[model samples]
Target: MTTVPAVSPAPSAAPAAGSPAEAAAPRRRRFPAWLAVVPLLAFTALSFGVPALAMLNGAFTAKDPSGGASHYTTANMTASLGGAYLTALTGSVKLSAVSAVIAAVLGLLLGQAVVTSRHQTLREAVLTASGVLANFGGVPLAFAFVATLGNAGVLTTHLHLADHGWSLYSFWGLVITYLYFLIPLMVLTVVPALDGLRAQWREAAQNNGATTFQYWRHVALPVLTPSLLGGFVLLFGSAFAAYATAAAMVGSSVPLVTLQIADAISGNVLIGQENVALALSLDMVLVAGLVMAVYLPLQRRSARWLD
Candidate 1:
C-alpha cells in the first residue's frame, strides 16, 4: 500500500490592502448607521433649517409700502424688541419663569415620592400617566381646562371658585393651566435622573452618621443639581413656546409673544406686518437658543454623574 502522501488543501490568499473588496467592507458596516441618521438630517433640514433661513430673510427685509419691491432693513427687528412688543416678550418670560419654577419644585417632590416608593405597579402607573399628560397640550388641553375651570365651567359653578375671584383667563389662571402639563413634563424629565441615584451612596451617607435630610442636602442635591436645572430649562422653554393653549385660554389678555406673533402674521393688529411676525419669530429663536445653551451644559454635567 504505497499510497502517495495526501496533500492538505492550500490556504486561501489574504485580500490585498486597499483592494475594492477590503475597502467596501468598512463601508458596508457603516451604511446602516448612516442610513439611520440620513432621514433625521433630511427631516431637520426641511422642517427647521429651511424655515429658519426664510425667517431670517424676512426678518431683515421690508416690503415697500407702495407694494413695489422688497428691501433689507433692521426696522422689523427694532420694532420686535421695543415698545408693546417688548412688553409682550417680557410678559412671556415672566410667565415661563413662574410656571417653570412652580412646576420644577412640585415635580421634584412628586418624582421623589414616586421613585422612593416600594410599589412597582405604582411607579409604572405614575410614569405612564406622566408621559401621557406631558404630551397632552395644545387646543384640546385648552378646551378641557376651559370646560373645567372657565368662568361658567362646571367646577367653577359648583365649587364657587368664580365667586372667589378665580378667573381662568387671567395671568395667574394661565399659570395654573400651564402647570397642568408642565409639572408632568418635569416629572418625565427628572424621573430618569432620580432613578440614576445609587443605593450605595445613600448607604454611605448613612454610615457616616448623616440624617436623611443631610444626605440629600449634602450629597444628593449636589449630584442632582444639573438634572434639576435642566428640567427647569425644559419646562421654561415649553411654556415660552406654547401657543395654542395660551391663545385659547387667555386670548389677548396675557400678552404673550406667541400671541403678538400671531397678530402680526394675520394682520390682525397691523396690515403688512408679516415681516414683523418673522422678526418676532427670530426673537423667539434667540431666546430659545439661550435657553438651550443653559440646558445643554447642565445635561452634560448631569450625564457625568447619572449616566
Candidate 2:
C-alpha cells in the first residue's frame, strides 16, 4: 500500500534573450489620429477660450490705472443688471423671442415644404439660397434693406408702405429684418431633421390604420420637437448677439443689448465704460450659454433617433 512519491515537476524555462518573444519589442503606442487636430485645438483655445476667460476675469475685476485687472467685485454685474442696461437686455430678449418664434414657425413650414417636395432641383435651390441668406448679415444686408426701405428710398417713395404701415427702422421692423437671417438659419437647422425622418414610420402608421394627421401629430411631431426647439434657441441666441444690422439700421432706436454694448465701448466718455461693455458682453455670453445648454441636450436627443 505504499505509493511512490509523485515526481516533482520541472521548473519552467526562462525565455532566451534573443528569442522571438524578446525580439518583438512592445508594439510602440502609435499616436492617435485625433492628435492631428492639436493645432486646431490650440487655435480654438487661443481664439475663443482665452478671450472668454479674459472676459470672465474682466467682468469680475475693476480696471486698474495701468490697464490690467484689479480686485474682484460684483459692481459690474450690478451695474449691468440695472438702469438702461437692464432695459436694453429686456428689449433684446423680447426681440430675440419674437423673431425666433416667427422664424421657427416660418422656417419649419419652409423646411418641411422643401423636404416633402417632389422636385429635387427645388430642394437644392431652396437649401442653397437658405445657406447664403443665413450668412447674409452685418453691413451688407443692412445696406440692402436700407436701400430698398430707407427714408426717401425706392419702396418708401414708390409704394408708400410707410404711408400705409411699415417702417424698417423700428422695433417691429428690426424683427422683420432679423427674420431675414433667422428664418433661413432655422431652415438650415431644421431641414436635416426633416430629412432624417424615416419613411418607415409613416408606412407603419398607415399600416396601423393611422391617418396622415394622426401620424404627424403622434409620431412626427414628437420626433421633430427637439430639433425645432433647439433651432429656436439657437436663433434666439443669434438674434440676441447680433450687433451689426441693428447698429446700422435701427441704431440707438432699438436700444438692444448689442447696440448698448457698442455705445458703452465707443459712445461713453465716462470712465470704466469699457469694463461696462465687457460686463454687457458677459451678460450676453451667459444668456447665449444658457440657450446652448438647452439646445445641446435637445440636439443630443434628436440625434439619438435621427442618427
Candidate 3:
C-alpha cells in the first residue's frame, strides 16, 4: 500500500514586533528610581532626622541653671550616665514591660473571642466599640477611669467601698488604665495574625483527637509567637514613652521620666534644671532603644512569614 507523503512541519513564526524584551531594551529613561526617594528624604530630614539630631545635640548640652543660654558639653552626658538617671530609666523600663504584658494578654484573648465568636452582631458591636475606645488615650482615658474608680466614684459609693484600697493614682491603677487601651490595640494588631492561621490545621488537629487547648498549644502558638511578641513590644514602647496619661493620672506623686522632663521644661522645678530635662529625654530614647532590641528580632522573623 502506498502511504501519503508525510507533511512537513510549519516553520515557527518570529516574535511580534516590539515584544516585551525588545520594548524593554529600547525604553526611554524617564526618571531614576531614586527620584521616588526624594519625598521620603525630605520628610526624614524635616520631621524625624532633624528633630532626632537636635535632641541628640540637646542631650549633650548643659543648660545654665541661672536662666542663661545652654551650651554644648560632655558634662550632661556624663552626669546622665550616673545612678539617678539609671534608676529613672530602669523604672520606666519596668513599668513599660508590665503594661505591655497586660495589654498583650488581654488583647490576645479579646482577638480570639472576636475572631471565633458565633454571634456576628455582638462581635461587630465589640469591634466597633473597641475601635472608638482605642483612640481614647492620655488624659481622656485617665479621667474616664478616675471618674468611675476614684474614692468618691460611682462604683465606690454604690459598692459601699468608698475607701477602696486601690486609689486611681496608684501604680496598679496606672497599669489598669494602660491596659484599657492596650487590650484594644492588641486586638487590632493580633486579629490579623490569629486570622492568618489556616482553618484546615485546626480541623486536622481536632480530627486527630486534639483538644482545643492542645491544638492551640501545638499549632497556633508557634506560628503566632512572632506577631504576639511584636505586639507586646509595641505596647511596651507605647506605655514606656507615654506621658500625658501618667501625668494626668498621678502628677509628680509617682514621678515618671516624662513627668520629670515636663517639670523641668515648664520651669516648675525647685532646681530649675533644664539640662536634667534634656538628659531625661535622652534616657527616654535609651528605653525605647531597649524595646527595639526585642522588637527588631520578632519584626525580622515575621517578614519571612509574610513572604
Report, for every candidate in turn, its global Cα lDDT versus the true structure. 0.91, 0.88, 0.79
Listed in order, each prediction's TM-score against the native is 0.86, 0.83, 0.83
Higher-TM-score candidate of 1 and 2: 1
Name the lDDT of candidate 1.
Answer: 0.91
Ranking, TM-score, top scorer first: 1, 2, 3
lDDT of 2 by residue, 101-163 (tens): 999999999999999999999999999999999999998989988988887679888998888
**Model 2: runs farther than 4 Å from truth?**
1-27, 31-40, 63-69, 296-307
Query: Which regions of candidate 3 deviate over 4 angstroms?
Result: 1-28, 63-71, 81-85, 162-164, 270-272, 301-307
Cα error, residue 180 of model 3, in Å, equals 1.5
Superposed by TM-score, candidate 1 places the C-alpha of residue 56 at a distance from the truth, in angstroms, of 0.7
* Candidate that beats the other on lDDT, 2 or 3, i.e. the better one: 2
C-alpha RMSD between model 3 and the true structure:
6.6
Which candidate comes out best when scored by lDDT?
1
Lowest-sum lDDT 10-residue window in model 3 = 79-88
Compose the digit string of candidate 3's lDDT tens values, residues 1-307: 9999999999977667877756677667699889999999998889978877877887788767678777888776676556555665666777788889888888998899889888999778877877777778988887888788877778767886655476777777788888887888888889889889889999999899999999888778878888898898788878888888888888876646777678768888546566667877877887678767877887787666556
The RMSD of every model to the true structure, in order and in angstroms, is 4.1, 8.9, 6.6
Point out where model 1 deviates above 4 Å: 1-40, 297-307
